[model samples]
Target chain A: MSSSAHGGAPTGQGRAAALDPKREVQRFDLHQRLQHGLMASSFITLVVTGWPLTTHGIGSSQSLVELFGGMEATALIHRVAGVCMAVAAIYHVAYLGYLARARRLRFSMLPGPKDAADLVGNLMYFLGRQKHRPKFPRYTYFEKFDYWAVFWGVAIMVGSGLLRWYPDATTSIFPPFVYEIGLHAHADEALLASLAIFVWHFYNVHLRPQIFPMSWVFITGRMTVEELKEEHGAEYDEMMSELERSRPKTPAPAGVPAEAPPAPEDAGGAKP
Target chain B: MRVLPPTGPGFFPLLGGKPRATLILTTLLLAPFGTGHASGPASAPTTAPTAGKAGPLPDGALAADGFTGSEKIAPPDADPLRDARWCRLCHDDDHFESSAWRTTAHTEQVCRDCHSGYHFNPHLPAELGPEAATTNEGATPAKRRAAAWATCQPCHKDAVPEEGIRHGLPEPGKPAAENPPTCRDCHGDPHEVLLSKSLPPVERRRKMNDRCVACHGDAERMKAAGLDDHVPAAYGHSVHGRKLDLGGERAPGCVDCHGSHETKDLKDPEVGRATCGECHEHATPDFVTLGDHRPFTLEARPVSFFTLKFFGWLTFLTIFALSMHVLLDVYRSVRVIMAANRNDDTPGGHA
Candidate 1:
């Protein structure tokens, strides 16, 4: 019944105090969180303006058109939103490069034999095929699958959208039919992505019994210490060991005097 | 009453033979007069001849006999088989030979019915000098032949009743103009009334479009009709019309979409949707939810708002999820790489 059991920590300043001895790990920073929020809102605007023209009748299209301030307004908003998505994608790629050069980037989201085993093992556990809990790494097979799907979705939507936006230019390089094909792919893939999010991603992140309301990690970009231990045990162990190794050899060097006594008593005192 | 009889001889003896002669003469004269009066009172009244009734032949009229009549009769000229008597002597067939006369609204009228002054046969041909005939003729010989149709307007003065405004006849007080659309304008030929039923479906359908375009294609006339002035121009450029002009039979002509005999205006709600759907079979309730005939543009609104709204919301939710996924992936990947680098730098760091 603890917050960490659902993969989140309590809010605000109390969050730090709520961290138990087994909890305490950092995942996303402020810049990444800001980019994510902007990208999400822009993508929403793009879908709102674009999808109505694709699936709905003209009457329905008009309201969406009016929402963006008439047909021209809708198109303009969509283009601007597309630019926003592109900027977000560019920032993500740049951020990855920075992380790689700094030796901070991780490949934990990549699929492996262990993830495959986890999938079968978790299915077995759910079906009452096994009595023991399945061992998991920092990212489960589902989480990895979700992560990879986004990259593929973004690549498809953005690539097709850009081609459609500059159709004449695209046709000059490719055939006119190519632009038409791109348009088709763009719309159909968008529909697929939308459905997948509703059925799969939404259920996993928000509607599941373990996380009935929502997973707040997307909003706050933090996880409790107990959450790190239970869901990302291996990562949690590695982080703690690194923290210990990085600690000063002695209590104080003269001027700095070691910030405060190691608060081992506070650790593991509260359930996050 | 006195009984004379045989004893009248006594009275006769007194008056002598003179009295007997006088009585005989008077009786004879009075008997004739009395009989005439009696018959006049018993005889039936005879009715006068009515208008258009057959009357006795005039004195100058030709008789069946070979005697020379008041008017000089020439020997039967021209082919006897094709003589005026061949057709006209029995029936008033002159009216039938005029352009479109038989096909016209006035088909029931007789020759004398309209041409009161012109007598049939033995009459001189309508006098026309070569110069005068040429001056009166139309732009072409065919048009000149069409002039015969004008004879109908004397009785059928108003030809275009459907046209709200009259244009050919002169103003109320002015003299009549020469521009009236004679029977030939619509009926084409008096002798050959084109029966609509006789035409095949394809020709009948094509004629419908032609009839509409006849007036509609004229920019000035269409403007006068209070219709879309750009119709002719726009239709010419449209894919359907252009294809038809290029000889594509499959292309939809005006009547192919609009009905032929039962053509209704585009504004009629019942016909509008059906007309558009005639070609676009996929025009579902969902497809035309916007109503038919929208201008093509980037800002053109769709027909159904609900479906659009649903997709819009769904798309936004999906993109939001995707962004979060990308963020989490970046975070996870960075952490993994950093952990690996640390392990690589330290001896036995993997343990």
Candidate 2:
């Protein structure tokens, strides 16, 4: 019922966001949005430069090399993007630390028995075997998998990348074969990461029929109350119950102060 | 066959204790142009040039002729040729080689140091042509810039080990079996031979790799010399090649495994193994046997080969399964979304 619902968002995603009601629930904070943005941009850049270097353009890397101006420019751009990705990853860790320190970190994203059951239920529902759809919490199993996959990927990529970036130093500490191993890990993981991003991540966020064109939630960092109820019924119920408990005992505006504590759902990116 | 050397006193440098030593070196340089270099040994002729050719050697007598060893003489404060401004007076068109040389270690060297045959007098039509590494033709056989060999050989004469020397190696330009690996053939033109000392070690290796790739990359060129043509193409696919392609310049290039001049050592498996040990301390015999190129075959490295195969399958399957899940989810979500849109006749209802 808020008049200012979904009124203003920085990202210009009007086409997809027109259907969205007032962005009521904060699914991600500004910091989380920033992390996603950095990862997304740097991941695209790494993929663009990396594929050519991996396949050698199926025979000759000349065309791709020329596309980026030359081999040197391609290399410089790839490394710069790599550094951006590394910084983004490190920043995410720091963000997590800040959250944990503030006692605001939630375990909803962590996989549990319910997540497994929901995944099975969702599959059964999708196949028409189940009468009712699965009820999801704050984070779905797929989202958690996506998040954790990024963590694993960043660790593998950056770890192996540093070894390649400074081979002499790497060889001095570790054996030569270790550098070779890093080579394989860096190349193979890149392919896997690229595939996951292009297929799994893209399909979930952009290519799916219901979410076709794109998911502006990545940019707006918010979801409508109705969307929250439909997609994450359990989370909506939890927030509603918390709101009920925290509701003012006094009914009249004259008795109670005009200022009320922020709603429980606002905890995602709540004002300090 | 050659232009008579200019024996002017103006041509001579002001001398030190080694007066005749410098003259002998200049005459030795001149001898290769007109004398028997192909038919005879690399050593200079006994007879001295005219007194005009004789100059006071500012460098030690052997320094000009002594192309061997790593004698790195720094360029003088106002080295005229350091910027190639002086060389551009007549030879202006070939600025590429000059520009490249300006940044190289040999900024101190003048055009005349290597081009000992060119004189103050008018040159012949043949003399004006570029010193290319080509087949020995006509009555005069050693058509390659004999001066380039004289300039380079003295400094790097000992580069090929005594036993490893293939005097008539039949290099790229001069494909005849009797021809040696002319410094021109590998280094391109003598002027642009970049002793890229200022470059990072990896960059220098990469530059040298270009020279190796020039001949080896060309199937016809390699075939003419009876070398395997596929080696260069195969190397581009190898892990080492991929590393280089990824801008890991430190990866082993052609010269890193096979010596620049001592390529004969590659024929010996033991020599290749020893070279492998030089860089890779733990290189196995089987690994060393991968030769100049083929490094990633199943027989060479079954474990790594399998590992790559495993990753390929994993990537394909994971993506496929994830994609199917998304598809199935979307198939249901579309119906659910449409049903919700039907229930709610709002203009903003999602499709």
How much is A251 displaced in model 2, in angstroms? 3.7
Clashing residue pairs, backbone N/CA/C < 3 A, model 2: B7-B52, B7-B53, B67-B154, B67-B155, B68-B154, B68-B155
How far residue B72's Cα lies from its native spot in candidate 1, in Å, is 46
Model 1 interface CAPRI class: incorrect
Docking class of 2: incorrect
Tens-place lDDT per residue, model 1, A109-155, is: 66899887876775554444664335566666777776667677778
The C-alpha stretches of model 1 lying farther than 4 A from their native spots are A1-23, A237-272, B1-351
Q: On residues B1-351, what C-alpha lDDT tens digit does candidate 2 reach at each position?
A: 011123322332342323345434544565556532212212221111112243222222222232323134322332212222223323445433445556544555666555544432122335543442232333122445353444566666676343565533323345343345466566665455566566776677667777777767776766766776667767777756765765555468886777666564654657765787786665545445443454555875554576678777878888788878977877776666676678775433221
What TM-scores do the predictions have?
0.41, 0.57
Each model's TM-score for chain A is 0.77, 0.83
lDDT of 2 at A31: 81
